[model samples]
Target: MASRSKLNQICQFCRCTPRTELKKCHKCGSVSYCSHACQREDLTNHQRACRVAREGVIIPPLDFLKTRKEKERLTEILTHCVPRLLTALYNDLARWMEAKSSALLERCINDLKLRYTPSACETHVLRVVVSRDEMWPSSTSTPGELFTVTKFQVMDVQYARESMVLWKDCMRELEIQRREAKANGLGMIAVVGIECPALATVRLLQFTGVGRYLLVTPAESGQRSHRRARR
Candidate 1:
């Protein structure tokens, strides 16, 4: 049973305003305070919640295209190895698909660009199909071929997890590369995808420490799209 307050008070530590009685800490439930100011005063007991709350916030994606400095850095990275790596990846897949060369690679990159750009049509189908009846050639054979469909399915899940881990690693490496580029007075571009509000807050904080930020929402069609189309 909890006693009701005249006005529902939020916890100063976690900023949680309970609709009902504010009896316990929403985060740790270790200390109880009636108002936000009171919760802030209890530094000793609420420190854990403060730290946890900080970590819970999400960071938004970077919009490197808007910043000239960021764009330059990103271009440098793309110019070096990234585009080549992507080309190789696409070429390998296309080779497996019995395509001539890496012409499809450019198409895949265009599709990725179209997918990211607002108001762009989504007609590209990026799918990989494997035939069970046909025996895979030695060059195309992977560990996935030996296992049965059920086992291969499990392996595919594991591979997806590993790929996500690799993607995160690539992001970290890119951040380091961007920092180096900035040190040399070069512009860099970072494209980030923020799914949650917490992520958006975290990204703002992170970018603020690095440099200034100008928030840009997805632009609507008309003038903006016409400009993008021309570019």
Candidate 2:
């Protein structure tokens, strides 16, 4: 761990701390930035440690992929693909905000910090389909997709117990569809919800030519929301 004086030193990107109030990186709870622009500038370099810190708290499910080969592929994505995607996503987010996405992300991180543990906040379900290219792939093209995602968030806040119920519902629905698709030789769909302290992303993935589908739900049960002391 860095010394207090080191963390208190000017922005992580540039030495501007003495001139301004510094804010710590909420995700890692380490390193401080004097401004959003400095945070954005330092993001690329900061992410290596940022990801390490986040993963230290929440290990990504690398074993979610069924086969050894699939697991390896997923590992490759987590190692190479995810960082690039996150960079782009963060950059886009930065463009939209007056204070930039880092500030927004900090607020979100703090909002869920006490109430949600990383482990409790993530869920993924997988099913096998017959054909890969047969289903509608886009969430926009598919009706009720947004509504379903929104409803999941609402459930997290309101009917927290129903979070598992919803997951089971999605699982059962996928199973039924998988069986039908297998009989007809068709493709499957998956919903993945990952709510990172730094960024919350719910993705609906459709493989163009694969049989496996995964669903990740964004709901964390109320039971788990009870705060756990940091080890």
Candidate 3:
């Protein structure tokens, strides 16, 4: 066996003391820290680097994609293709049994139906439907018909096990749908919208294989309260 000294050291950020116990960063095994507090403090500086490390390559967001055509293209891609890719990646990470496919899909569908509206202190949920033309040929009879619908829900906390489970289920469905679409020559895309803490968003991104994620804040008017606190 290799000597302990020869092994890669823990990140200074996660490690309490580099001279002794070495705890690596859970997100990116790169930078070392001594404690959660240190890791949180270093996050402001590590955000950009951590993103690059996780993605393997930096993709600068497109400024021009604001146009109608770009929007449509994006919608198609997300609704039709992204989900499957995420599912495949998630499967590779956790060798979950394929037998749970039906149950997983049903659970996702039910979750979509729950339809929790966003209110003060509550996360918002939205569903984006991809049109038929965007779906792979096998699933498309009419090009402009509904192809697939993606559901998104936001939460305030950081890395809740329940939230992670939901994300995993969504990813699995996306993967299955994408594969089915491809086999039948149909396009697959997915879109998600959520209102949650930035840290929670980052955790979600790292856990899920979705490459495109947008963090939106509630409007200022919604944030302000003309009336005094009730309590």
Best by lDDT: 2
Please give the CA lDDT of all the candidate structures: 0.38, 0.43, 0.40
Give the TM-score (vs. native) of candidate 1: 0.20
TM-score of 2: 0.25
Q: What TM-score would candidate 3 get against the native?
A: 0.22
Clashing pairs in 2: 10-17, 130-186, 131-186, 131-187, 191-215, 191-216
lDDT of 2 by residue, 158-216 (tens): 23224543344444554465567657865432222222223443222222212211121
lDDT of 3 by residue, 1-231 (tens): 857654556455543336755556677777766567787888867766777788775534545687978867876776678767655433322222133222232232234332232121112123222222322223223222222323334332223224554444544554465567557854322223221221122111111211111122224222322121222
Which stretch of 10 consecutive residues in model 1 shows the poorest summed lDDT? 198-207
In model 2, which regions exceed 4 Å deviation?
1-7, 57-231
Error of 2 at 45 (Å): 1.5
Which is the winner by lDDT between candidate 2 and candidate 3? Answer: 2
Task: Give one clash count per candidate, in the order shown.
Answer: 13, 6, 29
Model 1: residues >4 Å from true position, as ranges? 1-163, 192-222, 228-231
lDDT of 2: 0.43
lDDT of 1 at 37: 72
Q: By lDDT, is 1 or 2 better?
A: 2
Q: Kindly give the stretch of ten consecutive residues in candidate 2 with the minimal lDDT sum.
A: 143-152
